[model samples]
Target chain A: MRLQDQLLFNLRSLSRQRFRTLMQLIAMAIGVFSVVLLTGLGEGGRQFVMAEFSVLGKDILIILPGRKETSGGMPPLTGGTRDITLQDAQALSRLRNVDGIAPLVVGKAEVNFSGRSKESLIIGANPEFFIMRHLRIQQGQGLLQIEIDQARPVCVIGPELKKELFAAQPALGKWLKMAGSRCRIVGILANSGTGLGFDMNNALIIPVASSMQLFDTQGLFRVMIDVHSLAGMNKLSKEVERVMQERHEGELDVTVITPASLLSAFDDILAVLTVAISAIGGISLFVAGVLIMNMTLISVSQRTAEIGLLKALGASSRQVRILFVSEALILCLAGAVLGILSAEVLLWLARQQFSDLLFIAPWWASALALIVALTCGLVFAWLPARRAANLPPVEALR
Target chain B: MIQVNQVNKTFQLGDQPVHALNNIQLKISPGEYLSIMGPSGSGKSTLLNMLGLLDIPDDGEYWLQGCDGLALDTVPMDEEVRARYRRDHIGFVFQSYHLIPRLTAAENIELPLVLAGIPPDERKERLQPIIQRLGLEQRAGHLPNQLSGGQRQRVAIGRATIMRPKLLLADEPTGNLDSHSGAEVIELLEELNNDGITLIIVTHDMDLGDRAKRKIRMVDGEIVLDKSREQEPS
Candidate 1:
């Protein structure tokens, strides 16, 4: 028979049983909707984390004071291990492909400026910290390299710290007491938003030499490095490690974290998460497939005489099977369209509520959902379709 | 033309086999009007089914038109080839008027042409004359349930002949109708027969069976009587 006629016949048959058709549509739509929504959420989370990491500079690397374990979590510090010194940072800065380096010494101390005393975070680094962190001096001049090497008491304050200590007044050349030591405010940093889990606007920036004296610490906390290009990061990391190992007396006492490595680790974890959730949603589609089988069996039994009539009218077994299978494909494809539309509507609503979340279901996810739905419908429709096809026309007519 | 030789069909009723057709030998020519009359469970319907290619004989040689080689093997013929033969050469009318309930009378009549893969415009053209000849033009748009028993049977007849098959089989075609509707259906069958289509009817009504040019009586899976009013075959 002409495929158009067969399609029309199957459509009419389904229309006659409106309630059953509607129920099957709902089952399939629910299956497709769950997959779209959950995968959209997973993809959104992955994008959000990747965006945050991208903001930290793709070529930057952080070196911590311990080795990272394969089991993840925080790497334990080796006992009696000496702290990473400023000399180690200087040694790595001289390597090939190394653009710049910033030795970090972070602490919290009381700030007493103009009699407005508040406890704030202290970030201690050299003049190279500005370039490494992409920070611009918003007011006055930055600390000179000569001042950093001489351990002069000159400092740069963040925008928020400036507002708290100076209260809209010009703060350059003002004397500020950091912890127990007094320093001159040489520069004010521009208002950079919160990043890497800290508010850059609420911290104080100073020379490492001055911070070590004020905080009474001789050891550096962390080192940040910038590579000239992505191609040089791996070689530079190894070079840095080698230099650090030599400085630490043949002991590897530092953990090097390149953005590529960190992002890939996160990518692997989230990819698995995406698949796991999609599979969980796919279970519903499987259940919907079972429902299709049961419904098709019922339809076959009910339409026994009709099947006989078609066979008697010269329909072959293969044609009969194609008829039933086409019915399933039509139903599932209709449901897939409805489900995808509804999912798009849901994503729009989600976008309205959470502006930062990209609520898009990737094209492949949608395609996978559609392919899986169609496959499920066809596979599950097989047995009943074969049963209808193989029915003896004479016996069925009787 | 149709031919059957030493045809045998067996059915397993529970564990015991019942022979539905016993070594039956029959030959029918094109345009012949024949009827087989039998009591219940006497193999009348089984013979019709065999002729219609709806069933295969367990041991037989059967052929229709020029397709005799297919009957030589013990195994049944390929279903596709049989289906093609049926589409090209056979038509069937049932007692209960098996019109697809969802389709209108016109669509039901269009079924055979549709199955033969005739395009829509040609199918419409083919159906026009049959609709007028069956006097179903006014009732063409009605669904099966909306039509009376006589009208439904007419629609079934229209559907069966839409493809213009060479042979038409009607099994108890008037069984579900009142006497008046039954007579109309029988007359329709005879009219088609007179127009050069071979007609075969299976019935229990003696009067209906007697009206055919050739009459066959079957009892207990065997033919007891075969009589023809005219000696010459059409």
Candidate 2:
């Protein structure tokens, strides 16, 4: 038969049995839907992490006292480690590629401000810390260079800390007693929301010298260095490690983490995750293929006489087989179209609800879903289509 | 013209071999109107199936017009070649109507031309006269279930003739029809025969069998009698 006529005939045959057609459509749609949803989620996670890391600064490198063999989770402490200190930060700042350096000393301290006491985290850093980390001052100016150099008792409070200790009353220029030392609030930081497990709006940033005296420790928590460019990152990091090794009498105990390396590591893990999820979705699609095969077999048996009629009308066996296969293809194509549209709607709804989580079903995901579904339908339809084509016209007519 | 000699077909029924067509021999010219009259399992249908190239005999020497000497050999014909030959030369009608239930009468009639991959407009052009001759124009849009037995048979005939084949085979064309419808179908077959097309009908009805110009009677897979009436001047 003409290709168009054969296709039309198959479509009409399917439409004649609405319930069976609908069931097959739903089965195939569910298969494609799961694939799209899972893949979209994986993509969303990757995008979300990348976005979060970008906000933390891409040109920045973090130097911790312990060496971590693995890239993710908590870093493990290695034997014979030199302590990361403010002096090490000062030496790293002399490098040409190093634009800024911050010596961080994180500690929980009780703050008594205007007779209001609240326990909050303290972030100790130099004057360049706010600029390197993208922390903006909403009110008053950040710590002055003279204050940071002279160990002045001045601090910049995060928005949450301001809200807790001052409660809408102007906290800038106000004095707050922290760690048995009183300090003037030099600035109130803008409300940058929490991400990557770090709540920037919940801590108080103070000069590194005062923090060292208040926390009663010489070893710094971690050192953050902002490099000029990607090419300069590795050179500057090696220089910092060299300076630290020389100062610690040749103990190579610090781990230098470039954001690019960390980002690529995350990319690798999430990529594998995406493929693993797609594989699970593939298994579901395979089950749906089995269901399609069963349905096609039933349809072929039921349409034996029609198959015979076509053959008697001079249809070759290949034509008969194509007619049946076309029925499966049309059904799967419809299901795939429906599935992609539904996934888009679900993505839209999720974007509305979460707003921050970047959930997107990429074009390739839709294309792959369609290709997979069509291949499954055609492959699964082969046996049943062959069965129909092999029906002897004489026996089938009887 | 058609020729058959020593054609044999066997079937296996639970380890029992049944000879469905036993050393059959027949010859037919173009435009001949023949009827095969037999009871059930008498091999009439089997012979028709062989003639239609729907089945291959276990041993046979059969030939049709334009075929080579090998066409008369007992060797099996290639399936693709047989299918192509059937498409170019033969049409079939069945007792059950066997109409695709979902297709309209017009679509049913258009099937053969469609299978031949004729363009839609040309298929319609080729179909128009056959539909008109079969008196199916009014019922052309109706499905098989929506038509009467006579109407369904007319559509089947239109389908059978739309391809304009040299031979037409009908298996019990009126077996499920009323006498009026049966008579109408037979008249249609005879009319096609009068137009220089070969016609073969398989039936158990003696009345229908006797109406054909040539008649063959079969019993137990063997032909018992073969006879033809002398032609009357037009």
Candidate 3:
């Protein structure tokens, strides 16, 4: 028979019961839709995290005070240890190819201006802090590059702080009392809405020396190091560790997190999540295949007499088999198309909610769904088609 | 022309092996009208099914003349070849009309031509005359359910002949019809027989059996009598 006529015949056979066909289409379409949507959400989550990390800093290292070793449950970490100090940070800065060092000392302080008081996190760092964090000054200026011992009284107040204290007035160069100490707001930091635990829009940024005096401590919270080239990063990190070890009397008391290891750990986690979701989606497709098999079986039994009629009309066993199999294949194709289109609509809706994250189903996800759906249709439809082909024409007619 | 030699068939009915067709031997020349009459389970329809190649005989040699000038054996033929033979040669009409309820009368008639892979334009061209001759032109687009019993059988006959098979087998074609439509269907079959198509009808109605030029009576699974009209010119 010609391919076109045979297809039309098969289609007519399926359409004989419109509700059954529609139900079958829905079952298959949902199977495909879940696969595409789940994979898209999982992959989108990974991309979002990677984008956040890249925003934090690409070629940089974070040096925390205590050694967080993976093998040990706990370390001798707290209580008057030689915390990552400003001297240690300066020693690392002297190493070759080392460009930027921003030593952070975190503490909370209450600031008062014009009788409006609010407590906010205080970050103590040098001018390189702004460059490493990709922060641009929207107002007058940032912290000046001064000696660690100078204790400059100039502080950079964030926009929210300025709004609270100054309230639509010019706040730059105004003196505010922070923790009973007078400090001039040299610049107003712009609002950067990144929520990676360091929201600068509501922070008080001052010089490292001034913060040390205000808090009456010499220890540092962490040191951020930004380098220019990716090459020689291993050597640079090793040199940094060695310098810290020597300064701490041959004790490796600090943990240095290389950018590659940090990002790679996130990558491994997200990749596992992606695979897990895809496998679950695969299981759904399997269930849809089972449903298709059952529907075909029912269809075969229902149309036994019709099948016999076709055989009597001169269709061969192979022709009958092809007709049923192709019927299932057409169903899967339509389901795949419906699933993909619905997924696009869902992803679009999600994008509107979380504009920062990309909500896209990958091309491989679509291609694999199509291939798996088609294969599932074929494999599941085989037995029923064979049963229909092997039915005794004479008895079936009866 | 058609020839059958010692054709036999048995069915496993519960614990009993029922002989549906026993040593059936018959010959039919082209353009002949034959009828077989018997009670239920007497193998009259079984014989018809065997001749239509819908059932395979246990051990028999049946030969059918073909378009390629080859006398194809129906018993030992391969599955595909046998199916092709049926497609290119034989057609069947059943008691219930077997009109493929989903298709319209026109599509039912066009089915065999479609199965034979005749292209659309040619299928249409060949289908018009059969639709006209079946007197189904007014209701050709109607589904089997909407068509009357007479019209449905006419559509079935149109489907049977659209492929222009050399042999047409009808099993109780008038069983579901009233007297008016029954006589109309019987007359249509007779007219086709007169137009040089070989016709075989299996029925329970003896009156219908008397209209054929030759008649056979079956008891159990064997043919007991064969009679031909004395005035008929073969």
**Top TM-score model:** 3
After superposition, which runs of candidate 2 have C-alpha atoms over 4 Å from their true positions?
A70-82, A94-96, A110-119, A146-151, A177-181, B66-76, B230-234
Q: Residue B36 error for model 3, in Å?
A: 1.9
Evaluate model 2 with DockQ and give the value: 0.61
- Alpha carbon lDDT of residue A106, candidate 3? 86
- Each candidate's DockQ: 0.61, 0.61, 0.69
* TM-score-based ranking: 3, 2, 1
Give lDDT tens digits, candidate 3, residues A1-398: 89999899979977988887888788888888988999999999999888767766668888888777687565555663578788898899898878888998889999888889989879888899988887778898999988876698899988888898888999988898988798898988888755446778889899998999999998888888887687867888888889999999998888888767888899999999998998898889889889999998999888888888888888888988998899999998998889889988999999999998898988898889889899988988889899888776787788
Number of the top-ranking candidate, with DockQ as the measure: 3
lDDT of each: 0.86, 0.84, 0.87
lDDT of 3 at B3: 91
In model 1 chain A, where is the ten-residue run with the lowest total lDDT? A72-81
User: What lDDT tens digits, residue by residue, belong to model 3 across residues B176-218?
Assistant: 9999999999999989888889999999898999988899999
What clash pairs does model 3 have? Answer: none
Candidate 1's residue-wise lDDT over B1-234, tens digit each?
A: 778889999899999988889999998888899999988989999999999988889887887783342333322678777777777678999999888998999999998788777899999888899999999989999999999999999999998888888889999998999999899889889999999999999999989998999999999889998889786465
Candidate 1 is scored at a TM of: 0.86
